[model samples]
Target: MRATLIPHVPETHVYPEAISVEFEREGGLLWLRFIIDDNPDFIAWPGDAPVGRADELWKHTCFEAFVTTDDGYREFNLSPSGQWASYRFDGYREGMRPADEVCVVEGLDGGRDYVALEGRIELPVEPRRLGLSAVIETVDGARTYWALAHPSDKPDFHHPDSFVLDLP
Candidate 1:
């Protein structure tokens, strides 16, 4: 399924005119593509780096996914720099440990008007619900949060209500 992400709040001007995610889940593997549209200028994209586990990727421009599990949920962070992070959360924001599966950043491609990253995840089971989101950092060091749904006024992707998409 594919869905467009919206900013958490109303804004007159933002560097990225739009953001979207396309994903497909089959059994335990998920393929995802994050796209930034409309002349992605002033966006601080990470340069190419070795693919490895990273911490606090959310602190910069990153694509993220929250998948539901029986006892808790899993969080996947994919960066354009080829870095990725996965964590198993016991609950809303509890028990965060490295997830069993390490997600892979397949590719990062873009041009003057757009940017995109392809990633894959091997989950223990198919996710029934997912919260797709992204943190976009600008040239001036400003950040904007984008998600399929924002349950609160602030950008809190860990909130349960943010998992608004149900896989079919």
Candidate 2:
């Protein structure tokens, strides 16, 4: 699959090998997991929003996590109370717009906190253009956009250098 650029941080630095993904199905749910190695010092504060340190970690790292079934798709959001908030996407159709969601996952002790972002994407019948974008902050206060371009059918998980973030 080929990845292209969408608007994002211009100076974003990504570790190609630091990305790992897995897909599995359990009972009536389809799961996709994405783990990326991110610096703990890099925090996300949503546009002057009031967020504590722990809350910031949850907001920045946790993108989205959910389950899908043949009947439709069910999405879950992580609550500050540490509970699962659920939602359903009954409007999902074969040729409709791609479904998008974001959530945060708490890290286990001794593990570096990270973000888990996912898209319950639907590919168009014909080749449809799509962009995968992410924003990360550096310890030095620089924000960069990491994005890739690929067809909806094939998600781009390769490093930015492979095609998405090609310098040229």
Candidate 3:
């Protein structure tokens, strides 16, 4: 399914004007695609170097997915720099650990006015809920958080309330 992401708050204005996230399951692999409308001043990681298991990618431009089943959830971060990482939480933000078993392949497309990022991963099983979000950094170093829903006063993707999308 495809979900259009909106800013957590209306006052936080940034580009691109529209952001959409699409996810689908094919056998055991989960496919993800992010489309960002053209925004001239959007900041993207310049280098295309291979991004190996990195921590705290949310500090920069990154696409994230929070998948939950029962009391636990899995957080996946895919950056424009070709780096990706997944962490499993026992509940909320508890028991965080690297999900090394889950391999991911990600790519970026920014040649045109708009940009697109595609990612695929092998999931252990289908998740009950999915919270999709993106952190966009601009030329001026301003950051905007986009997600399906934001229940907190501040940008908090880790909150269970942010997981608004129910999966079949």
Q: Best by TM-score, which number?
A: 1
Error of 3 at 149 (Å): 0.2
In angstroms, how far off is 84's CA in candidate 2? 3.2
Worst 10 residues of 3 by lDDT: 40-49
* TM-score-better candidate, 1 vs 3: 1
* lDDT ranking, high to low: 1, 3, 2
- Best by the lDDT measure: 1
lDDT of each: 0.88, 0.34, 0.80
* Residue pairs in candidate 1 whose N, alpha carbon or C atoms collide under 3 angstroms: none
Q: Write the per-residue lDDT of candidate 2 for residues 1-168, one digit (tens) a residue.
A: 222233232225453224333434333332344445554445442343222212322233233332334434433433222322334444332232224433333322223555443332222122112223344444455444334433333322222222322111
Clashing pairs in 3: none
Task: Tell how far residue 156 is off in model 1, in angstroms.
Answer: 0.3
User: Model 1, stretches more than 4 Å misplaced?
Assistant: none
Which lDDT tens digits does candidate 3 get at residues 91-138?
978999987436465677765676888997555454788889999878
- How does model 3 score by TM-score? 0.89
- TM-scores for the candidates: 0.94, 0.36, 0.89
